[model samples]
Every structure is written in C-alpha cells, then in structure tokens.
Target: MKTSPLEQTRFWQAQALGDIEMLHARYVQQRFAPHVHEGYVITIIESGAQRFWHRGSEHLAPVGSMVLINPDELHTGAKAHEQGWRYRGYYPDTERITGVLDELELKRCGLPIFDASVIQDPQLARAFSGLHCSAEHDASALEQQTAWREAVLMLVQRHARVRGTPLPGHEPGAVARAKELLDSLLACPPSLEQLAAEVGLSPFHFARVFRQATGLPPHAWLKQRRLGRAREMLRQDCPPLTVAFALGFSDQSHLNRQFKQAYGVTPGEYRRACSGH
Candidate 1:
C-alpha cells in the first residue's frame, strides 16, 4: 500500500517506440498499484534484487534473471534485498510481438512467465538495452535508430516464444527450437556449422527442415530480417553509422551499397527523405 520516492520516480515512462519503456526502480518499494499496461514487459535486473507482486503472490527477481510480464497484467516492482534494484525493460506493444507470432504462425500463450534464474543470454540483453535507449530519446545529431529495431526484433524472435506459445497444428520439439533460434539471430548471424551444433542436426539436414518450415534458406532469412529491421530504423531519426553497424554491415558504405541494392536508397538519403534530414 505504501510507496517510496524511488518507487514513484521509478515508474514507467512513455517511449518513442509505441511499445517500449525503460523502467528505473528500487528494491523493496511500493506495489505497482495493480496497474496494467497495453504491452508486454521484458525486464532484466541490473543489480540488487526485486520482489514483484503478481498472480496473488510475490515473485523474487534477482540480478541476471529475465522477467517476462504478459500484456495488460497487473504487476508491481519493489525491493527484495537491502541493497535495492535497477532494471532495463522493454514494454513492447502486444500487437507488435503478436504480429510476428502470426507471421510465424505461432499460437499465443495466455500469460508470460519468468525463467527460474537469469539466463546467460547476452544476445537477449543486447537487444533489450538497445530498445530502451532508442525509445528514451529521439535521434539527435546522429544516433543509431536501425540498431534499436534490430535489438527489439532479436529479443522478440528469441524471447517471444514462451509468450506466444505455439500455433494450431504446431509440433513441439527440437526442430522447433532451431526455428526459434534462427528468428532471433538475424545479423552477424551464424553459419550452418554452429547452428547445426545448437540443434544437434547436420548442417545439411537442418537446412532442409528450415527451408521446409520457413520457405526460405537460412542465410536468406537472416538477410531479409536484417534488411526489414534496417528499413524500420531508417524511418526514425537515428544516425546512419549506428544503423549500418547494428544491422551487421561493415559500415555506412557497406550499408549504402547493400541498402541501395535492396531498397533502392542509401540509409542516410532514405532517412533524410523519410524522417527529415
């Protein structure tokens, strides 16, 4: 019932992206006031500990743990330890993630759940941090908007599974995991060699099934995703350099060549024309 200064100040703030926010909170503060947001909540505790009230009980959020809160669910963040807590969160619009699930033909999971402990997943974290930074402020002189979208997509493709569950006639198995993995990592990407290792399939076999399921070659899928994300970033006021690097291109020149080839416009020229120079 009672809240502290950190609690009130630590609440969610609107973001540039329709469905993202960076929540700064302290440990052992007041309850989240039984509120609901229009999007999903993906939070990573930076330090200290947190106790979130939801589902009729308190959930302990230790540093390193990933918290996935379902959209429109009632929840709150407070301290669980003496030191306090800091978190990087992405409150993505339900439709954004759901659209991807629909595109992937995935069924929706009723509610989101938390992993028992924090995962050793730098990729997910990278995607999350990028989302918050971009959403917090519009691109200034030149920041990377493209990179931000890339991260958000990566987070969605990789971490959105549990949230969306599976679509009808979906087969749950290792092959499923492989598909999910590919969706998450679309840049700098991975070779069949390493990818095969992840799913315990021969590269050749994996390729076959991947094509069958997604109707696209592995490498091609990665490129399409990266380019698609890049295009979204170009719509924002972010710097070209950041976009190029974030999309896994060598640099602006590299991005220029590929981008023009793909979409018929250089990143800078496109942003200037679209978002305003």
Candidate 2:
C-alpha cells in the first residue's frame, strides 16, 4: 500500500489527463488503499470479475461492464472471482470534464458508475473502444479527446444522478487547498508534515481521514498522478531529462530510477515501447 512520492504524483496526474494504465489481474490479491484523487476513474471490465468497494457499497463489475468513479471519492478494488479479472480504466479530471460539459451546454454531474442497457450495445461498445484507442494512440488527439468526452457525458446523463456530496471529508475548500499545494510540488516532493499543515490536518489524522474519504494515502495517491503525466510527456518524445525536470525530479537519473521502480521498466524502455521503437 506504500508508494513513493514521485509515484504518487504520476498516478493521480495521469488520471486527471485521461491517461489510464491498463490493468489485468489474474488470481491477484491487491488492495487499493484509501485515498482521494483529483480526477475521474472510468473502467471497463473486459473479462472475468472484480469487486469495487465505493461510496460505502460493494459493486461486482463483471465482464463487458463499465464503472465510473467521480473525483475524490473513497473506493477500493480487487479481484472478486477465483479466475481473477482483466480491465482497462481511464482517469479524467473533473475540472476538465466540467469545461467540456459547459461547452456542450450540459449541466455538471456527479461521478457516476452508471449501469446502462446501451453500454452493451454494439455501437456504444465500438465507440468506447475507439475512445480508449485515443488514450493509447497519438493519431487522433483532438478527435479522440472529443469522442472520449462525448462518450462519458452520455453515460453520465443516462445513469449518474447526483447522490452524496464531494469527498475527502474535508470541507471542499480545505480539500482544494491540498490539491493546490500538491500541484506545486511533485518533484522534490514535500514532507507529510508540510502537506498536512497546508491542508489544515495533523499528519496522522490526515492520513486516516483522507484515505477514508479518498481511498488512498495522500503520498501514495499523488505519485500515481505524477507517473501518469511523466509517461505522457515521455510519449511526446521530450528529452528524458527534460521530462524529469518538468515533472519535478532531481534529475534524469532520479526520474529514471523512480520511473522504473514504479513501472517495472526504465524510462528509456517506456519511451521506446510507447514509440514502438
């Protein structure tokens, strides 16, 4: 359940930007420790089954199903069946989504894990696959972004009715403070003490309360965001050292270490794989 500061930033940031790391678990026992994120989590169960504990409920997401988690909600995930599961997820920021909704003249909506009769529709499935392709390939940047947004918006409209309040148990104002402070430092990451002070919580209490509200420890969650963004930049063919610098690492070497540590491969390897070199 422990993750380095660098990894924390990578994970959450990636989700904020619509970059998802595909996950396929087979007979696995992994805990999605408690913490909140700054983005939405959209997942599709491609095969097998999984259990999602969210908003004080357990959802069994089976094959050919989709799950959407609103920003800053407390949730946990793991395999629900013996054969385990395979799934893909997208993490998109609420702020960005709201902007799109405004453009489309749709009201802002809550994070919804909608169950739809049409989700299994062949047309919708094809659209979903195409949108997910945009997440993986670079060819249709604008087209895919638009398509992805539309797909999500429609899903929200169909299934997500406003439910409870926003998450992390902190006043919305206080939680926003934490996000602001975190945004300022993913590289040379801050100490928990400093972060807690910024968010107006004692460190120990912050860890417990924040996780209960968000589903991950503050630090571990943040690293995932940073790693996600770092990967996107690297995919852009930016110099590895530059990617490190932009994301707030000590240097390329430091970035490489953390990148490999979190991703199970070197930065060069990641870039090469992404570029299909």
Estimated TM-score for each candidate: 0.44, 0.53
Poorest stretch of ten by lDDT in candidate 1: 7-16
Which parts of model 1 are misplaced by more than 4 Å? Answer: 1-15, 19-22, 33-35, 53-58, 99-120, 140-145, 162-277
Candidate with top lDDT is: 2
**Candidate 2 residue-wise lDDT, 163-197, digit = tens:** 44456644555555665677667676678888788
Q: Give the C-alpha lDDT of model 1.
A: 0.59
Q: Ten residues in a row with the worst lDDT in model 2?
A: 7-16
Candidate 1 clash pair list: 27-79, 28-78, 28-79, 107-166, 107-167, 109-164, 143-239
Name the regions of candidate 2 deviating beyond 4 angstroms: 1-31, 108-126, 134-139, 162-277
Model 1 lDDT tens row, 39-99:
6667777787778666557788777777766653555566677767777765566665555
User: Best candidate per TM-score, number?
Assistant: 2
